[model samples]
Target: MAHHRVADGKNSLRRRGVSRGLVFMLLAVLLVASGVVVWFQVGDHVGREGDAAAATCVEGPATVAIIADPDIAEGLSAIAKSYAETRPVIRDHCITIAVRPGDAKITLDGLTGNWDPQANGQYPAAWIPQSSVWAADLVTAKPSVVDGTPESLVTSPVVLATSPELGAQLTGKLDWAQLPTLARRDDSLTEFGLRGWGSLRMAMPTGAQSDASALAAQAVAMRITRTTGVLTAADASSKGVAAGIGALTEAAPRSPDGTPVGAATAIADAADAADAKAAPIHAVPITEQRLFQLTKADTTAKLAEVLPSGPTPLADYPFLKLTGDQVPEYAATAVADFFRFAEEPDHLAVLTALGFRGAAPMPPKTATVTFPVTPNPMASPETAAVVDINRLVFGPTS
Candidate 1:
């Protein structure tokens, strides 16, 4: 009886041991399965870092290429150098920035290979185009080109920069209403005709090509309740526009050599040109951060800026990151990092120094305005239209 009981106990112990072993094996399998799912879900994140490391890990400096417009190249370059200062040390990656300047439309055409991203393939890590309207074209062309969204870094206005005297004669205030009066007053008088701003010694052509000329034409049409003929290159070069700005300039003060004094310089020159109380000859110097820099640097203080009254059309500068199959994941990461650096306060200061208006004062969320419907470059006939003065001065469709 004692022997039979001992045998039973041993059997019970063996059964319990087997059950525990099975549970342990089941737990191990579950852990392995969980790890696999995590790997797949987080794969893109790890892959991006790996790609950045491989591309920028060479013994020499890493290259960050920037394709931008010529007007802002100097300032953009300065900002890039400032970004490279700490980014490389922090990320263990060396950065080299290269800038290429051209019209935004031309730049985009080169990227998508006929406005089709699927066909053209990806090229640069980043592109900072001059106009938001142009950036809108890219977003319409390939919705996913720039991190799947559009981003603008700075804002500036396309203003009719004029001498201070021109600003005063128009309205005592530099508003749109002053344009037609300036235009009509200087009509048909070739020698400092109303079209030329009074031959104010300087010969800045008053035609559509001039920012002020387009503003005048638009203002006149808006005031008269007519659809101003689209600001075509022809209209800009037309005698009407030229004669108007010419007349305005005629009232302007000029140097001994007959060169028109710039707005800031005109102010200082006005002090010398006439009694101290007289207003100086002012150029509607387009109000831009760059203009401010120029005014500070000019010893004569000839250029002066006329701030807009309301709802002025401002230039929007966009910094875009291009992504597609051809562009490696690592390149995208580096490009993204560079963009973040650009938004830093110190970096923005550099941009401001270079005449770029910083993206502040406006709400942070307002950096980019979105469209309800994404434009289809292939479907839209307007995509292929060549950029001309009329399109630029007026509107894309106008």
Candidate 2:
């Protein structure tokens, strides 16, 4: 019996030793796995840290993105480049201003929605829309997103651009009411020895899609309604005004393809054709500033401005900074710097040369123009929407 007990005890001892060996092996595997994981995590953290450091090294001191109307892009770009070259450091950051020129409506729309990177490039820190109405509209829609009060950078009232000869011929008294008579295809000018002026072909910036066109439409609407404060949806949809708008739109110049050309292109075409003693468009609704720019650029197409009786829409170029996290602190400061730089006396002179009228007194040699003391705000967003809808619904089919 004793010998049997001794054999059993030896077997128990062997089992115990095997269990201990297995426990040590399991602990060793777990330790090795934990060490590997820690090493990998440490290496990944170091890599991320290195990448951040590199990014910091390559980043500019400060960068500001500005989006301006395409019409004023060249001048704005020149100004931005010059400012960047001579600007002092602001908030310990040497600033860089990247100016991108885009369609006023399209750019505003992008701001209202998710910005399209492919179409609009990088997000803009600031916007220099063609008119304050755009900013007003934006504020109306998203007031919380508006950072600060939009400041008018410069002013340019809408004008009727005409060829030099045609302008000379129409030197008599004409008001906004005569636009339909003058623009119609009939031979209404026969009494004036002009015979047939080939139906006053005209061009506008963009029907309702742009402020230039909307303002012109509003001017025409005012002529129809004969009330100038604000054209409500009812005013826009009125049968008489709607019909007048249709006539005006129908008179807009179209390409050979029957599509309406943009304002800038239309002006360029008129300028090009004028050298051949032929004007493609008899008149166009354009900003006075734009007329100045055109005259300077193309000598053959020196356009004269025709101011109407009623209050006209003024392109109060507004300098506005975007709100939200997308626009960083540094960017806002940089944008403010550019705005201040632009308003400086020297910079204002540059703007004057580019045909923009500053808020300050008109400098020597600049055109002397008077604007209405109390001009209406560019159509409010709601009014603008109504105007656009009316345009699409009543646009001239002819």
Best by TM-score: 2
**In model 2, where do residues sit more than 4 Å from their true spots?**
1-60, 81-92, 136-144, 191-193, 205-211, 228-234, 255-280, 297-302, 360-398
Q: List ranges where model 1 is wrong by over 4 Å.
A: 1-62, 87-95, 112-122, 140-146, 177-287, 359-398
TM-scores, all models, native as reference: 0.51, 0.67
lDDT of 1 by residue, 326-362 (tens): 4556567777777787787766666655555565332
Tell me the lDDT of candidate 2: 0.64
For model 2, how does the per-residue alpha-carbon lDDT over 1-398 read when each residue is reduced to its tens digit? 45644556655655435577899999999999999999999999999997665545444477678888766667778788889787546555667898888776677677777888888887888888777656756775666667888886777777776655566566455566567666674765443456546556666445432555556766777667776556676766778776776777767664333212244344445644333235556666667676565455453544556676666667777888887878888788778888888888776666666667775554333232223233443443244544453354334222
TM-score of model 2 (CA atoms): 0.67
